[model samples]
Target: MVLKTAIFFVISIAAFAVMFTTMAPLTGFLSYHDVPRIVKDNNEETNWFALTESLLWDIFLVLLFIVQHSMMATPTWRGLIYNLGLVVVERSFYIAATAWALQYIMQSWLVIPDYPLWIIDTSQSTPWWWFFTLIHVMAWIIIYGATFTMDLPELLGLKQCLYRDTAWEFALICTICLTARFTNKGIQ
Candidate 1:
């Protein structure tokens, strides 16, 4: 039991690390040197094969991610894991696999030159831009905050090992608080 809990905790932390690394660009909080930004200036010069090969590799990564994620969600896969005595860390395994796939995609993403999609010039210092940026950041904050209202341990596959039945009551209270907080934010 101790080993299971420790493994789950470590995997959960790793999952969060990967998730935050992927999401930090959207929140303007991370500027990792090796991590590719989802939205970047398309004027930089890149190797021709880099674009094509990277794009193909990215597609393959996405397919792998989809297969791993969907397959693990199926009953048959769960049964297999159960039969294999990996039921306890099944969700953690899924999370870690998905995170690895995502990290691969992010790391290998190609920056296409001369292919501007949507470039918001932050240098202009427009009030509306800042306002919308604030709203965007707040929206993400609210979304993450709302997750506290749910069965997070179960969602993370730690429910059976770490959480008690009473946690549901706390979840419900958090839901009410989330709703109130959102309502208050919306009003202001």
Candidate 2:
């Protein structure tokens, strides 16, 4: 029992690390490594057999992400893992796979040609840029705060071997806050 718990703990930590690392690029904060921001023309010169090659690679990455995400979340897949005696790390495996897929997508993303519907120059409109950035940051904060209000261990499947009841009242409050935040964003 102790060994199993230890193994699961390690897997969970690793999955979390991967998820965290992928978030910056996924959120358009950092492009790949030290690249500060991703621009539309970032992949203009990097072509293979043709420009279609890059587009095809991007499409392939998206398909890979969809497949891994949808397949692993199914009941049949969980049952297969349970039958294989690896149910303890099922969620960790799913999280790790998702993180890997996201990372690959971010790394291989082909920036499409510049065809902006609207452009906001942050240098000229600093105040407006900061305002929008603040709103975006607040939206993410609300979402993450709501996630923490629930039984996160259970959500992550860690509570299966160690049970903990969720605080329904807190969850309800968080849900309300999340809904309000989404509505406000939609209005804006």
Encode model 2's per-residue lDDT on 78-188: one tens digit a residue.
999979877767776887788888887777777544433345556556787677777777777787789899987756656543421245346658879888888946743
User: Cα miss at 11, model 1 (Å)?
Assistant: 5.3
Q: In the order shown, what is each candidate's alpha-carbon RMSD?
A: 10.1, 10.1
Clashes of each: 0, 0
The TM-score of predicted model 1 comes to 0.60
- What does candidate 2 score on TM? 0.66
Candidate number achieving the greatest TM-score relative to the actual structure:
2
lDDT of 1 by residue, 1-188 (tens): 66756765676666656655665643443222222335435685665676678678767867887887898789998999879866656776776677676666666655553344445555455775677677776777898889889987666666643542446458668889888878956743
Computed on alpha carbons, the lDDT of every model, listed in order, comes to 0.64, 0.68
Residue range with the least summed lDDT across 10 consecutive positions in model 2: 29-38
Candidates in order, TM-scores: namely 0.60, 0.66
The weakest ten consecutive residues by lDDT in model 1 span 28-37
Where does candidate 2 stray beyond 4 Å? Answer: 29-53, 161-188
What is candidate 1's CA lDDT for residue 41? 52
